[model samples]
Target: MKKQILTTLVFLGIIIPAITAQTTSENPYADSYIYWDYLAAYKSGQATVAFNNIDAMLQTYPPQKEIAMPRELALVSLDQLLHDTDNDQTETFYTFINTRMMRVLKDLDRPVEKGLRIYKLYNDGFIIKSKKATVAIDLIPGGSNAKPFIKDSIIYGIAGKCDALFISHWHADHANLNIAKSFAARGKRVIAPKGLWENVDPMIQPLTEHIETDIKFDDLDLTLHVLPGHQGDVLNNINVVEFHGEGTVAQTGDQWGTDDLKWIDHVNEKYDIDVLMPNCWINNMKRHLVGFGPKMIITGHENELGEHSIDHREAYWMTIKKMELLSDLNMPYVLMTWGEWYDYQR
Candidate 1:
């Protein structure tokens, strides 16, 4: 009889807690909410209140062991907010987030995770928010055949969570159909140049919505602007998208419009961009700077996994410095590679 009682108690202990966890999932940040709140608030121009709430939340849930990505993000976002403000405001916000809000997340079992990467312009995490809705872009690993991306997991993870994805063009260097499939499996809506979508595998087709012109998917708060790409064929539509509250970033896709000032100027005229995330090839970048007018520039389409393909790192730096030289004409330019996410202050 005693043996039977002990077995039942053991079973109950294991089963009861899971049952309890399921029954009490009332907390928004409980399981994991990709925090679009901070981004949303920033986009809506509610900087102070947004800062206050996020700060309070972080302070209440300070980092602990078993770190989770979302919790770290809350802290990172709080840091960015305070850093963007005046010194006094920064200190106050820091105290609020670190001391109060973070503690709460900690209690809820949300601790800051490690392995997040930072670049000049991008961040690695599970969520990307426009000024409006927030979407989850979780990174998944690819096989050895996968095209190299700097900070691979970080980039792919967020790409996976994107509600609307942007494929610059069809070069294997630019488009990873396999990666797109992962995002598709989760019901994400991808936006790519029409040509790429046509050639993309059927598995990825269901996940995409194509736009042929300069248009905005307002529901997603994304603006799709197609420009001349690397090869310059009608099928080669290089896209630059503006994520509403996250500021504007132009994806050169695989094409760099190095020879055409007119097209780059056209892009500048069409969008009030904060950063330009483009492929960093000299033929593309040099001519790109003449017409590229963004405060920051990020390099993409470079091999992140290999040994700095083509000694490309130095060339990327030189191109950025040239852009900064132009910034001396009043447009500051900073070059970044992968591992960055756009953050905006509405």
Candidate 2:
């Protein structure tokens, strides 16, 4: 059934890509230009060759349209690959996703004049860019093993384009000492909690808790209001970021439990947020939505961490169920897979 759905989507995308509206696909399908040699080889048990083909293809894949059917195709393949334990021992899984992440880097070069453009990386990783400045939120290198998902150049490449890096918490997946160092070395601001690597790296800046405390980034032309949130007992910094003219966006970094609800329940009264970035899974999702009261919601933290357990990894299909629950609110939201992006105009 999954393969059938993927085939149908790809077939429709190939037919509709010719007609485009600037960055959007006319029909939300995709272009006819995806290379299928890798999928064919994967079926034939030539895993390494398939990985090589995908690597070559992703390195040069033209991102003319933002939402493509091919992206759906790639994600379906990734979902299957992560579960296939045979490939876990090999470098194939990480190689495929990392290559796609590099594709996201290619699109960031284009400037956004009117509103902020957001690129969704693996898990909670996002790149929010406007004409004024570029910011990376929870931008992590792929995989949890000693072997990194992305290369050093890709990490630095992302660091080079951004003016600041905002880390929500010290979770291994959300925060990276090396990536933080890249931003800090360039004199760009790196805001994280003083929990994980703060002692190791003094350059990391911890924001004051509570929304009343607004931290100013004069050099980057940005203002931040942080909610001292917690994921279980761990401190999670729920960032309410204000860009001068582009409008305000609130990012909830692994916000869990009822401890933060004191502020979260009244977030709507505090500020008018244009976009709300939140994890798809939480104990009280709808309440969080009402509190933030965002014009639109772009959910992250879907299908991340590692492939140790299928359930823990959190599949994209699960997000479909999550959105179904939130449908009654009539709130706008985008459920993006790894390497997908959405641009917002406020």
Candidate 3:
């Protein structure tokens, strides 16, 4: 009898743990209860449920906490759906649903409540935003030009609650007539170089604001300073964004020169830059690093979009290889734009 009892006890121990583990996995509503619940609602295609739940989450949590969790979870779901599709085990409907969700998830990361987000808009144009400011930059579209990407980027940045946006130039690819109108309709304010507003569509005219050479907003906990530079002896305007609360990011736009480098030196002296987002300017990446000493560098106009006149699809990777040759760096220290978002973290 005693021997029988011992065997039964051992069996119970193993069985109980297994049952408990199963419960843990099945209870998707464990710690991340709200996210899991919302995921279920999204998966069910219950639009009302999803919207209501999201509204609740917005009210309940800070923007960062609210958006990050759902976005990440949605990505996980979409990736799984994609994998299943690739394996030929999923239907077209599943793939479509996942794609739609992915877009929504990406949208949720805009600069909200002081958060920072950068998304790849259409081709070269991007909208950069901070807490209360937004800038739309028009890049010459084609392939390597930096326009459409900025469109999506602008929304992404603002969705993350960034304060301002910078439009580097008035090139065709960088600015879109119809899209600019929409931004105006949405009441998005933009900051740009001297000549940019002159070239923008009149529909967006009201949204445009010319940033002075040096503009200070004490309430912003930051400053907006314009830096003028030349790309291969051609004058190009750039925006210098300085963050005082914690971190700082310097955007070179399409400008590169002795003048810009001088501004970068001032930035380095004044504050520590966490990231440097610059367009490829005659391959002078090394010079800026010296002046800015940013902890990370994210390049723009690098991704190649086929069927397009110009594409810098491999610009980021190429820069990485070049940087590697100069220094064995791989991550945050060296970075490049991928799409509406950075694929590295994904």
Candidate 3 lDDT score at position 183: 49
Worst 10 residues of 3 by lDDT: 337-346
Residue lDDT tens for model 3, 148-225: 322344334333332334555555544444444444455544555555556455333321233336656565565756
Q: Rank the candidates by lDDT, best first.
A: 2, 3, 1
lDDT of 1 by residue, 104-175 (tens): 222222221221111221111123354354333212232136332223444444454355555555654445
Ranking by TM-score: 2, 3, 1
- Residue pairs that clash (backbone atoms under 3 angstroms), model 2: none
| Candidate 2 residue-wise lDDT, 1-346, digit = tens | 9999999999888765533333352323224434243343344345655666544544344222232455445444555665555666466666666666777778788888878887878668888887788888998886654777777778678778888888888877888888898888887778886455555455568754433457788766778877778899888888888888887888888899796787789989979899888887766889999999998888888766564476766665565567678789988776565665677887
- Span of ten consecutive residues with least summed lDDT in model 1: 116-125
lDDT top scorer: 2
> Stretches of candidate 2 above 4 Å error?
1-77, 199-202, 208-212
Which of 1 and 2 is ahead in TM-score?
Answer: 2
Residue 130 lDDT (model 1): 49
